[model samples]
Target chain A: MGTRAAGQVGRSGPVAWMALPALVFFLVFGVVPLFGVLVLSFTQWDGIGAINPAGLSNWRSVLSDPGLPHALWVTFEIMILSWLVQTPLSLLLGVFLAGRQRYRAFLAVLYFVPLLLSSAAIAITYKALLDPNFGLGAGLNIGFLTQDWLGKDNLALGVVIFVVSWQFIPFHSLIYQGGVRQIPTTMYEAASIDGAGRLRQFFSITVPQLKYTIITSSTLMVVGSLTFFDLIFVLTAGGPGDATRVLALDMYKRGFQANLMGPASVIAVLLVLIGLALALILRRLGGSTTASQQEGA
Target chain B: MAVATSAQATSRREAPGTSYGRKLLRLNWLGGTAGWLWLVIVIVPIYWIVITSFKDQSAFFAQNPFALPAEPTLANYQLVIESDFPRYFLNSVIITAGTIIPAVAIAFMAAYAIIRGAGSKFLAGVNGLFLMGLAIPLQATIIPVYLLIIKMHLYDSLLAIILPSIAFSIPLSVLVLTNFIRDVPKELFESMRVDGATEWGMLRSLALPLTRPALVTVSIYNGLGVWNGFLLPLILTQSPDKRPLPLALWTFQGQYSVNVPAVLASVVLTTLPIVVLYAIGRRQLLSGLTAGFSR
Candidate 1:
């Protein structure tokens, strides 16, 4: 028995040894850099010259900064608007296509086009489309819709949110469609035999089965929208009086544009904390739902 | 299941104008019509961009964007090509390919290790460590990364872009690959070990071949992410010669503000490769993303 146990240990030894390089890389590059950023958040540094030792000053400044509050509000606004618009639209589209296999393939391709294009390219195309004069925005006589899509305080953030939603709706649709496809046909047949309407069956069967996918997709959306920077950066550079400046954009401006490494690190650390909080919330929600599902089973 | 299949078969074999048949046909028609409408709506903006790229300067300015260009000309394409666009394309290709190969290979090894030792605490810690990459927003670290690049004398070089791209890709690649490897049955690995297969032999001969689908998905994901990346290239490479296509498009926008046709032409050229790639891998890519939902 001792020999057998020893053999088992020996068999597993090589596997653990093989994981060493990956562990070392993760430690030095991933964990250390993150810890470095957290440490730097407490110090004052201009990204050059000697780093002045400051204690909690950078964090205090970030907490009190007006831009932080404004950026947080815009971030949440964009996240909420994106989720609200994209989720329902994607579900409708997913359901619409679920019954038909032939043309669904074609429609899926079409919907995924925007996702293939680079954010820079998309921003440029939309910029041209939204050009206030002598562009698609003007030609369509929807100048109101086009009016400073990138430059206006009221419309810039909304436009960014719309663009993000448009790009990701297909992604959400794909998830929803996958979930919808997994529902056993017998349930639908039973519902129809009972004279239930399509909407009624949908609410009773479709949405409940899709709970996990919904949670997963929404988690992704929240994290993605919160950390969104590339599209907004290219589209407006957080213009029109910082109206569209989400937290990521604000962090970029602080660190890269303004070269305030210290405060930028603070914002970054905060963003990480926000992501962690959301993830924790999601875990709790996911765990309870899964437990309840198992209990029901 | 057999009864349902036979029922479906009988319905398929039924006459065209019967109640059930007509209902099915009508459902098909409704689905088809909505699908076509969605296709049209989604394709219009892309159509607009492509059409605008072909228009001459005057036609570009005078005509409606939704309408086709009158007297299509290749002058805009020619003009962009004659400029520094070629150099930017080369830079983009080099950086993307350079980053993807090493990142995928390293990630593959890491994923294999983690998968083979399912509940090992050290591997779990390593996995968690990689997840930290997801949280470190690029905006926060751009400053330090920039300083680090400059201090290392790698600024404005292809290395700057490649390093950060590869670094960021590790987490996602590791995530996807770990999931993929986890799905590989442990029996295969155990049999290989029983046969006295070396670790390298098992990875090269067994695991790598079985993970082809996952590899393809990961490659497409990595390719898209790297190819479309703009921020690192923007800050790291100031030399126009070193800039990639996205930055090149930005340059085109700035340089030829009045030459709108030329600007649109550059955008078309920049987006074409990725569009073609997506068209090829659309099914696999969508499946991969949805696969994440299942996990």
Candidate 2:
């Protein structure tokens, strides 16, 4: 590859040669497969049967399927729950840790434990703890507390939402912490001097300063919600009669287990579309805050 | 209390409604308590798993759930080790290396090219492609990947898992590595060119050594994801012998569903290697991650 640029190596020439392998990999793996998915989406194909053109039928079936609506509802439920729970917790911890001088490093590392563990590992730990028969909760004789968390139809998804938020809070916290650290301490000092209490100063200063980070982290959470599969897959396997059957899990079930490739691709495309739309909205919202803040300053 | 700084004491004694200018001067007990509580929540499950790994089945049932093992035994661990744990571990090692090495290597080149060839339309297009790759979730792509692997006759092999994992990881690696490479001063490249260094020579001598930490960071970051991956292994590979640790643990549960101690012991064994690596090399890994935000 470098041979082409051996004698006539312009500024871009060698660089292009260096980039060739990576470009090829993405083209083959990333770009081509994406197109393959799109083409495959419009065709009805079981893994073994002759592929037949769907003529909009696959899209129609996927959209019209009763499961789709329920899964969508459940997915959004998890999203809203995670956002509501994960955001405040991450921000609180992030802001507190950034402002403190003591045990900051120790606490950050400790909090980061769940982030590093595989989702599977975390699922197993929780499953063990929430075990109906002899789990930690049950073993401890907390009658009201223990309720077959994973096995029940009503509680399984809530437990999943809690666990997923727990696992991801640290990641979002680090982002928020960085944003908080960048805010000038002088701003807080001035606010305090102006008769603003800690609560008042937090709203007036910390929230405004962290606008962009909040948007970024929120977009990530939204996307995480859209594509959540591992925890659901690991713990309950979307069980107790579709109590936790999320879109990603639905896609997996349809594609792999049920062998419905077209519908699965439809689900995938829908997920990507939702993710893009949300990201764009967040970016616009985040950008406006920066502009407004600049004017205020 | 006697050793408290004047600023800390003053801030604490300041009236509740009246604000104090001294910030970070006093411990915010409310926030401190909240932070400590969150830490306990995060660590307790891990503590339970680790402690439970040592207890025998009877001890695990008889003793308190969070209690230390009264008659700690290595029997569960031994049973797991004898039951194909080594094979599963080896498979994971091979798969992780297969994914990370190529993904990071190719990404380095691409990042280098993107930085040095900044003005080129093609390079810019490549950069955009990697960005697009970031938004594509793994769930949507699995059906196609499964079909492609079957088409290529690579299904159920470690190669199958490795290929798609590398594809998914390259976008982030390229993004991070490109940011790092752009920070390498232009003068370094200019000086190298003046010495008649070819692009290959320049990359070997200058770029590789400079971005070495990013390389390690990308490798470990992607390696860990692949190591813990469940979806790909669950769908792509079918053989019990070929399953990685996560899948192995999942299957281990099914086989030993009655034996809770053994299942947790297997989980502990699966996670131990990464935990050790994290404990030792955390600062370097996290700093590399933290550096990404500055850009």
Candidate 3:
């Protein structure tokens, strides 16, 4: 294609030839590997063994597996929980900090510190913080709040959700701040002169104004929550009888731990499809609103 | 008598403060109080981690978890330094630097071409390729990546980790750099062209110099991502000697289940570099994020 395209340009040009490296890169690393993953999904091959074609047996087994459904449920539950908790809080914080106040910079830095730390670090820190004994929760007379967070079946996923939301809120706050900064200050001034209170101005001006950012941030949060693994893997390893076993972790266990590569591929494909579907829905909704918002502005 | 009563009643009806002033004062107080409370809540965990790292095992296990160490000792730091942490840190630095330099360089050139090149079709197709890389999550490609690493006899080596990190980061770097390059004045490139500068020369002399800020921002983004990565390193490196900081910290956790202080100490050590970087680059980081969103 590169050669053909270069020829079609009908100019003896070195500039067109410069694009070959990028083309090769996209082909080898991007396109070929994707095709390989798709094809390998249908075959039964251990990490070492020869590929034995199984003709969709892996897909069938993945569909029939009870564990996959449970994992999906856990994933969706955590995704929704994190979205519900983080979105509104981050928005409020962003709006509050976006104003010309002395402490706005200080507050932004304070909130963003968690996002810089490694997920493993955050997980380990929280595990210690929530320790049933010999930790803050114990020393502060809040032992009831700790409750064997990682060890208990009922509280395990909730603990993971809380930790995830804590790490991610700063990121969403930054996103919302960007959106809020784009909003013209004159709009707020006009509302104030019309005798509107702060709450009325916020609902009528801010929320309706930041619909695009809200959509983008929520989509990112949902996809991130659904496909999350590192922190959970490090903290609990999906233990305490699979209480916090999300679909991503389950897929990792099946593929890498148990060497069920075929079934793991199926789960991965499904996860991708779900993520794409969510992104599409968000873009469609935001598309209509963004047009109107632009026109209104 | 009636005139005296009217004057007294008129004076009594006036209160000390006006309604508008009182309400403004209350609103200011409420906003200030909420802002300070949020600051405390946000900083507490970080303070906990840092303070815990300086305490000895006994201090950590004592009754007061939140209290400052009575005799703040460097014992945990000594332990971390004496252990394999130095090697793990070196590996992490190598992998991160290796990935960032090449990824940023390649992305810069590709972005320049897409911005400067004539055909919209070609540019759009290239952009779509990078976007595809972003949408495909790592879980989907982990198996294939593992197999490819083994086939190339690169398992248990730093290259295995570095290659994948660079590959994954390219999409984002391209996205960011393209946006920045598009913002570059077109006359700069056109003038360089009229000066008889080749494409390579123009890239070196014009575009790269102009996009340094964006390059630094992208490098920081990629650096943090690679330094903190867990899955790729976990799968690629089996030898304890080759594992990076995150995986090394995981090993420490596994081996020292009873030694909470030591594990926390290692966590602190693992997170220090990034924490320091964030502290220095907080403003740039926020601006970069805003720039990314605007694009």
Candidate 4:
């Protein structure tokens, strides 16, 4: 028995080593930097000079700053608003594309083009397209088609949300389509026998069946909206007057652009905390997302 | 709104296949309207982009933004090509390939280990760590990553971008790849073990081939992310020559802010490679993505 047990251990030993390369890479870069961000938050560094220990001063200033709250509010607003706009649209489109018709399939192909373009490319396209003087409206002679879309506070926020939806709705729709297809047709058939109308069937059968998918897609959307740096940076640079400044962008401006690495690290830590809290809350709302998704599959 | 076709009508009459009967009742007018409406919303920008890219600078101003170019010109493309565009393209290619190959390779190995050695406590813990790693917002770690890169003297190098990208790709790749590896039947492994094939041998021969579709799926998914990655390249590399396509496009736009057609041409040029790859792998990429996420 002892010999056989030793033999088993010997066999499994090599298998364990197989996981080492990825684990080491993740630890050095991923895990270590996670702690590194926290450590840097406590010290002062100008991003190009030697770091100096500053204790809790960085935290105190960041915590008291009005800009922090405004940035947080903007982040939450974008998060909630984008969620509001994207969820139903994606769900509807997902169900629409779930059909195997050639036309629907063709539509699916075009719908995803926005997903393939880099965020920078998308932002640049929209910036030019929304130029009030020379943009689409002027060229097409349509009133209300053009505005200083990225110039004002309210309109800039609205354009950011619109652009976010324009890019991601298709990807989320694809997720929902996959989720919708996994529902057993027998359930729909049973509902039909009871004379459930299409809307009734949708609410009762389709929505209920797609619970996990909704959570997965929602989590992706909400967490994703937190990190809207590249797009906003390219589109408005958090302008016309810091109207579209998000948490991630705030961190970038504080650290890199403003040369205040310490305060930027503080914001980075805040982002990490908020991200964790949200992911945990979402997971609690619907069991383990990955586990439920795997079971559904 | 329900644009019923002969195919749909025929499918409705035929015996209800897995999805056919559902489709008949699921004919949603609202959904159809929204889908077609969204199609127009999606296509108009793309059409404008392509058509505008072919127009000359003066023509861009004089003509309808939506019009197909009357006297199409290659000047924009030529100008973009002259502005170190190929260098940036090559840089993007190198960073993407450098990151994806090793990232996918190591992630696959890690996934294989986790699945095969499931009962082992260490492997289970490692898997759990990766799952937790998924929740960590990678962008938040940029400051520290920048510091580390500087410390390691890798700042302003493509390797600086590639290294962190690989780290970030690990968590999801391991998760997706593990799920794929788990779906392989135990009996197959048992049979291989009985044949005296070592774990390494089985991994190379059995697990590798069986997970080929999944490998492709994970590759395309990661490749797209890294190819279109803006943050890493933006933060890590400083030199103009070192810039990836996305970063290059940004600088190009900055320099040619007035040259609208030239900027649009640069956008088209950067996206053209991915479009070609998509056309070739559309089926695998689409189905693979649906399965990857849904699964």
Measured against the native two-chain assembly using Cα atoms, what DockQ does each of the candidate structures obtain, in the order listed? Answer: 0.32, 0.38, 0.27, 0.42
Off by over 4 Å in 2: A1-9, A99-102, A189-195, A288-297, B1-17, B21-27
Q: Which of candidates 1 and 3 is the stronger one according to TM-score?
A: 3
Candidate 1 chain B: 10-residue stretch with minimal lDDT: B12-21
Instruction: Give the docking tier of candidate 1.
Output: acceptable
- Deviation (Å) of A103 in candidate 4: 1.6
Off by over 4 Å in 3: A1-27, A288-297, B1-35
lDDT of 4: 0.89
**Chain B, model 4, TM-score against the native?**
0.90
TM-score, chain B, predicted structure 3: 0.86
**Candidate 1 lDDT over residue span B52-124, tens digit each:** 8899978877887777887999999999999978889999999999988887888888888777766677777
Model 3, B181-270: lDDT tens digits are 777787776677667787789878888888887888888888988999988898888998898998888888778756777888898888
Candidate 2 chain B: worst 10 consecutive residues by lDDT? Answer: B18-27
Alpha carbon deviation, residue B93, candidate 1 (Å):
1.3
lDDT per residue for candidate 4 within A87-117, as digits (tens), equals 9999999999998899999899889889889
Which residue runs does candidate 1 get wrong by more than 4 Å? A1-9, A141-146, A288-297, B1-37, B131-139
**Candidate 4: residue A102 lDDT (0-100):** 98
Candidate 4 stretches greater than 4 Å from native: A1-7, A288-297, B1-27
The TM-scores, one per candidate, come to 0.89, 0.91, 0.90, 0.94
Reference contacts preserved by each model: 0.36, 0.47, 0.32, 0.66
Of the candidates numbered 3 and 4, which has the greater lDDT value? 4
- Scored by TM against the true chain B, the candidates give 0.85, 0.91, 0.86, 0.90
Give the alpha carbon lDDT tens digit for every residue of A1-297 in model 2. 233244454657767988888777777666777778888889998887788889798899988889989998988888989899999988888887786575887788778778667787778778888887778877788886678787788799889888998899887787777778878899877655555557656777998878767776787788768777888888888887899998899988988889988888888777777777776676678666464322111
Best by lDDT: 4
